[model samples]
Target: MSSRPRRPAASSSGVHLLSSTRVITALVSAAQLGEDDLVIDFGAGPGTITAPLARTGSRVLAVERDARFVADLRRRFDDRPRVRVVHDDLRTVRLPRRAFAVVASIPFAVTTPLLRRLLTPGASGFSRAELVVEWGLAKRLTAARPRDLESAWWSCRFVLTVRRRVPAECFTPAPRVDAAHLAVRRRSEVDRRTSSILWAVLSAAYARPSAPARVSLQGVAPRRITHRLLGGLPAAEVPAAVWLALAQTLAADRNVIPPRGMP
Candidate 1:
């Protein structure tokens, strides 16, 4: 975990300043936060976003994976009763069934898993809350990264608005790529069919060693490969479970060669 003071000057302007105090204030104000909501700031580095969210009179679970950063956050918000610092892996960390919103300075790699955990079913899943995260990997889902893009798109529909081209120079060790803000409100339930389709696509793609090449063949490769590999497997109009079974079977067979899905 890295530590840096809130740059009062740099915090006031620029697109890269999404996590800055000023930007967070604006975001929260725009959100019209409910007073009782629990706002979880995932990957809270130095409590920049945490501080303002706490001011909303909402309890804030400031989750930071870094030991050093968690210590710093505790010391910073020691007096604020509303702030609770959780030092653990945000990915697997479980919380009580308390309703809350989530504000994240997300790590690009784990974004999908985190979103699924929040929106999917069961006790470990989050019920309802406003969410803010990066828009990376938000494009249409493919067989290769089905769950990845599926989760991103599922959350995207609830997005009332987005702030794009946020500058990258706002952090101490600034990231190379620009970031965007996705202001999301959780949906009641995710579409099971859509999620199923996405999983089928991705599971099949990743199973193949030449996944990148196979996925680039566009929509034709899955059908063509299914046919050639499964003795002319018919169109996938059947139940998703049946298609999933077929996809799993084909994906696990290394002997089945696939056409180039990408150039």
Candidate 2:
């Protein structure tokens, strides 16, 4: 029998190569890929996850910043026409104009920035993503009430959840903390107008995150509606759904113009 190909050593760039084929397979399977889908493997370290993603017959864009791994990934997937290897920084890479899904075990560092590229409101054609991220970060992202403004904004347009926890030993040169499988899927029901309105509301509320919702949202909505929706909760503790409802209420009313200058 042929021995499994050896994986390269971990790099200073925070690439922790998943050591177990079983774990890699499980991550890919959760993506539910097929021939018609387009998928991206961010930080495609030595093509471990890329290989299985290709097997699903989905068009795979294996993006890696490291030159050595880019070369190795090219050579490994050369025979697979469906796999396209792109050497670029994940943070700055241009996302697909067409609909796409992401299935990746990203580097531990730069997790937040990378996700911002994919999940930020108005990001083009991002349908779903299954990411392996730091456990603490995952918990914060999937919390009942988003602690930060960005997480709250992201939750408005996508559903963020922790699918499962992955042990540290699953990777080479194990990380200090365990990781979690984070699932993100865009909210199909949220239209462009709703997203824009939510961004406005969330930005205003989070501007004074510690303040009571009524105070933060003062001029943005009617006192009766704001009080009815938010009650006594602090702006930071207000759920994304409530934010969305507030935006929708504002959108329905012709008199209330949504706050301008969305970032």
Candidate 3:
């Protein structure tokens, strides 16, 4: 996005800072920004990572909602054409159109929502994200190899990784719990719209995990894949790849026969 003259949006006082310089170095090093890369410093409070990001030769868009922080950022990078300070709420603002990397210590409350926006499948222009967020969420994002139902769907979209643990003291008003840096790598695109829809089925199944997989999948899985011929297979009994590759597609096939046996 082009650099525009911005006015302060609001006064800044209460904001979290990724205070340690070592962490900043780690984040930037991991981002491995290129000269042509467009990087977003989301919730760029007082431009903590902005200066270093600019020095990396990549164009930086520092978005801070607070007017005071915006003013501070502009003043700090007054002569640096590479850094454009934007005064807008991170949630409502439109991100850049070009492929980009994000390295930010954003508002912890908006962590999931922000991720939902940038990491949604078909969400173009995002190559990767290295964000400092709540520890529990970071763990969940990278927990399983295929992770959860959400990650399974995202597996078609991006790679998720949990980096170093960040101490709670890294902020002004320190959080009660610890934090961590989570990285997301974009996956190569393919025709996975049907597979993507299967994620909703998986999410519903997992929502009541204690229920037998057969019972959980009953409403979502097609009868051809669930009948007596297929037997009484529990949800846990079936591999997700089967759901992605067979169930739906097989349901559409006219020549296929439903199983005749029961579990």
Best-to-worst lDDT order: 2, 3, 1
Best by lDDT: 2
Query: What is the clash tally of candidate 1?
Result: 10
- For every model shown, the clashing-pair count is 10, 0, 7
Q: Write the per-residue lDDT of candidate 3 for residues 1-263, one digit (tens) a residue.
A: 22232322332454567777777778888999999899999998766688778889999999988787788788888888888889998888898777889999878888877887787645468789888999988876664334355554554356677888999886666778889988888755333444344555566556665565556666556656655322454443444444455435643665644442211
Per-residue lDDT of model 1, residues 1-263, tens digit only: 23233652222222222345545665567556667777787777667777777777888899878787788899988888888999987788786576667766666566668766665442332434433444454332212223332332343223334554445564435556655555555444323333344344543444452344244324633556654443422222222333344444554555534433210
TM-score of each: 0.58, 0.93, 0.74
Evaluation by TM-score, superior candidate among 2 and 3: 2
On lDDT, the stronger of 1 and 3 is 3
Candidate 3 has its poorest 10 consecutive residues by lDDT at 2-11
Root-mean-square deviation (CA) per prediction: 10.2, 2.3, 7.3
lDDT of 2 by residue, 81-120 (tens): 8899999999999989999999998888878898888887
Tell me the spans in candidate 3 whose CA falls farther than 4 Å from its real position: 1-13, 145-152, 189-263
Model 3 pairs in collision: 9-67, 10-67, 213-235, 229-259, 229-260, 229-261, 232-263
